[model samples]
Target: MSARLPENPAPLTQALDACRHRDPEGFHRLRQAVAPAMLATALHFVQDVRQSEDVVHDTLLLAWLNAGRFAADDLPPGSWLFTILGSRLHSQLEALAGRPPSAPRAVPTGLQGQALWTLAHGLEPRPPSASLGDRLTESLLARLAAPQLPRTPTGELVHPPLYDARLRRKMLTSRLAYQAKEGFKRRLGRPLEEWAFRRWLAQRSVGQWLEAQGLPRRSVEAALGDRLDLEVNPGRLVRCMSYPDAFPDRTERRKASNLFLWSGDWDLPHHSLADSSRTRFIQDLWTHRLEPSRSETFRRLEQQREQGRPLRSHHKGMLLDSRERILEYLRLYLLYMENMACFGFDKHEGKDRLGVTIDRHGRIIKTNKGLHRLAMAQVLGLSEITVRVRSVHRQWWQRHAGDAKGRDALERVAQALPECVPA
Candidate 1:
């Protein structure tokens, strides 16, 4: 007799909860539900039915072992299962093919015959339909059945070449920056600075260059063309038509192009540029320099105004309307700086230093240090100076401020600072 299963409203959620609570039945149900999808995803990576199946089995075991760690709000059991399957399959594929598993190559329509011929020599099961899942299964089966294709001779599977993670991260960062800038431009009705936009383009260009060198033609086209919206046709034509003499030496050209495209400028003395510099520039651009501008912030505020609704107003008027609000803006700036520091901006100079000192014309009158302490006090919602000194800075400023408290302390501090007139 078929076993009866529990009828829960959200079986997946219930299974996850049960697994967290150490219920064997819930764990089994979750495993069974996710196994097929994991198998399918694994096959897509490994391209060998037996190995793919093995990978799925191993992945399921691992998932079950780690089931207690799974959160209901995180990915569903199927997706989590797939992640494990994909990672294991990648390792297997790397071993068998002697290279990393990259994005799948697009088989040409005419090459279907070749693929079918390849499968015929292997143990791939032919499914009734050519659905994506079926195709994946077929590919895996074919690879398993015929591990040694005559053309390959050594019985190795054809795999795409591996790229360093740094390249991938750089590419992704540039793409995100471009999208963010475009979104900002749309909202603000003003284009981002040309230099900034070009820098983004350059990083994308470097990624394309690496992909062109490493990826197969179809894979290269798919990755650069479809995802990044870059036209590889023009790049291909340029590569084909240009004579060796017209370009710098191969090594120089690659280095220059990588830097120029990724760094967004060819101004550096090409011969003198070091690999560290190139890497540093890419790292800096990726982390610190590629953020949405203040213009975006103001534009968003304006948009809210146009919609006949607005953000909360203080007694002075709109939150962004007065000079005091500049302090609030600077607080966000500090947060941005902190984010940059966390994301590999430590190497670059000036990134560590806070900008926007309160100045009259060109002469510096005030600094962010005092403002930050004040802002932190406000954020902590302190009302009394004695309370703030005790709780916030721990009486560090008591000797200077005397017994002053609250707004009076702030006023006294500001008055004490030198007020240099505008130049």
Candidate 2:
């Protein structure tokens, strides 16, 4: 409503405070937090790109006007803006539907995802999928046998607008170099308690840049969040996020953000942990319960055999050349995972704990990382296993992370961890 500069890089809630007094700079900062996603999802529903921009502009105005009524604790500020944006898009679409037919706008429609092998720059609309089974099935099977998801093998994959993996790798190495110079002993054992704390200091900013660009930074955040060592119950993880292979072809997973609500029912079996082949493979490996075909990994590998992707960490020098060798490697991997579940997760693996996210309602949503271990944890009915926070819902952040930053934020999040995670 008005204008003033924040004296510091205040948290979103504090920025909202600046807005209460009509600081245009605060409104601009607020726009930076939520507008990218508001625009992204608006494009998904509003067919005309120009019209979508109009919808976003109107929705932000509504958000701005209502900023005083916004409650960071009751709901994430981003989610609040999204609720308004969704309504605006609905009304816009309705108005268009009521209008008489007219010439199509020459401006380009937007693209949500892209292909890996081609120059084509858009997502192929998903063909109609088979409708899901009972809601009970989604709930029961989610914690059961869902596949490692973000099913990039076949999802609408996307990346940060211009980032590639080689570039990302260089970025990480650069950060670690700075940390090393800061006197953090990368080689030494840190008390488990300090893991997340240290991460808060060094990398809380890991995916903040992506929020302005309107992407789900969860992938990178999970990989790089406050790397807390949390021993959570296997049952606590009742759901997970699902998307098709949409991680940047260059980066390992999706772009990161804690702002928008991506999807809640991603925990459903149809979404993850229930791929027929993966389910069959789990049955074959863990229980001999299914007379399944060969592991899907092998079949997938058969096609990619020409690609010659090396089996990472295989003891033998390898290529996708030998089935017998691959089988042995799979068996060893199974055993290694088993030992971690049965004997207690590695005491010496340092911060390589299972990565997880917390939803606004506090559900443990498993990420694309650590699918094998997650499955094992569920199947074995292990009571507890260590994990780290990758990213959390903005509502989760407001309640737990609050307005705190640095060690204060770390301490707040750490105290809230086991308590906020569902029992």
Candidate 3:
């Protein structure tokens, strides 16, 4: 009799065929294949390493349970797994305490300091015949010629008052005087004073001016809408008026001042209700000694098994906390870049601010974004105008290329841009 053929095929082949036939992989090959990207996606969404890992674990379980529904053609094994990971991650993110999806910050990649140092310094060196002194001198001169650093006034640096008392008093006094000069007695049938009416008029005037300046009407309305609402306080306007020296144009300073006073910290109520003091305190703590503290924490955790101590709750908590901080840092960095692209400067004018000059036409004339975009385009041998045109014609590309390639192409274009643009 012929030897009986082995009944089962190789696991990988069996698994692939099973996947094609929509059979669950009892061997967990799918989990192994997709775990790294899933983990990265989870980490990005949750901004906490432990939580992200937990999310990955849950994602694997879900993928296993729903494996039969996965179509080999529609999602490919990798993307199907990532879809589940992303869904779970979004759910977890929505449930996080004291954090909004719109939070301005981002998390860091948590790259090791030594690794980064080595990678940065490992670039190709100049030829031996090149003048090292000339290069060094040029570098020094470039650094010296960089834009002036912003100086925070002594009183403005730490715990600055929301609005300077003197400024507030002056603004109130001016409004009262203006009302008297206008002879605007209480024309309203209600018992409101002339000064209140004048304040409303001032707000209306500013709103109209903003509309005329081509500011998005919705944004202007949203920023100033409740000016007439008695319950809403316009303290931010006072703060803006107090910081005239911070603004470049006198008219913009005045408009911003009025807008701030009228708006009175539009974000305050949302933050207060959410009770984000803990989050802010944690952020400040992380920002203070991020590198050293992160290194020590990583080292301690790495040696935990050999130290005869199992991972304690506190250690786990610290790791999660640090991961969140790092994630937040990266998110913030991305946002800073996005804001610089849109607004010509960093919103907060922090140390990371790129002080590039922009032209009146919203063209980035001399800013880092312009330079980077130009340098990237040149490196890729793409015209600067072509890059901009491609961005504008993205919808057409998407229509023709379908979703995946279109997205991939767009991302590639973005990555290649900085190389073409001048830095």
Candidate closest to the true structure, highest TM-score? 2
Judged by lDDT against the true structure, how good is candidate 2? Answer: 0.46
Model 3, runs deviating above 4 Å = 1-27, 97-423
lDDT string, candidate 3, 1-423, tens digits: 111211232432444455445444432454434454455555544667666665555555445434555556654444444455544454355436424332222222222222222322333221211232243233223323322221122111211111222343444454456566445433442223223333333554443343223233223233333321111011111111122333446865445422211222211221120123322332332232223234433345336534655242221121212433333333333222222222222122442221121111211222122233222222222211211111112222233324333224334423432332211
- Local accuracy of candidate 2 as per-residue lDDT tens digits, 1-423: 112212233456766776676666666666655454555565566656566665555555555445677776776554445555554554455445553111111112222111111111132322111221132123223322222212122121212211223333444454456567444433442332245434445545533333223223333344335544566776556555554532323333333423232333333332345443343454445542111125565566555545676343211112334554455445444544334432344433422356666766766666666666666655545566677666565566557766675556545765776665642
Which residue window of length 10 is worst by lDDT in model 2?
A: 112-121
Instruction: State every prediction's TM-score relative to the real structure.
Output: 0.23, 0.38, 0.21
Weakest 10 consecutive residues, lDDT, candidate 1? Answer: 232-241
Candidate 1 on 1-423: residue-level lDDT in tens? 112212232665666677666555665666545545444455555666666665554554445445666664765544444444444444355446544222222223322322322322333222212243343343334333432322121122321111122233444454466677667755652322233333323444443343223212222222233221111111011001111332346764444321211121211122211122322332232222123223344445446645765443221112343333333343334333322221212212221221112111212211121232222222222222110010011122233345564334434533432331211
Best-first order by lDDT: 2, 1, 3
State the number of backbone clashes in model 2.
20
RMSD of 3: 23.6
- CA lDDT scores, all candidates in order: 0.34, 0.46, 0.33
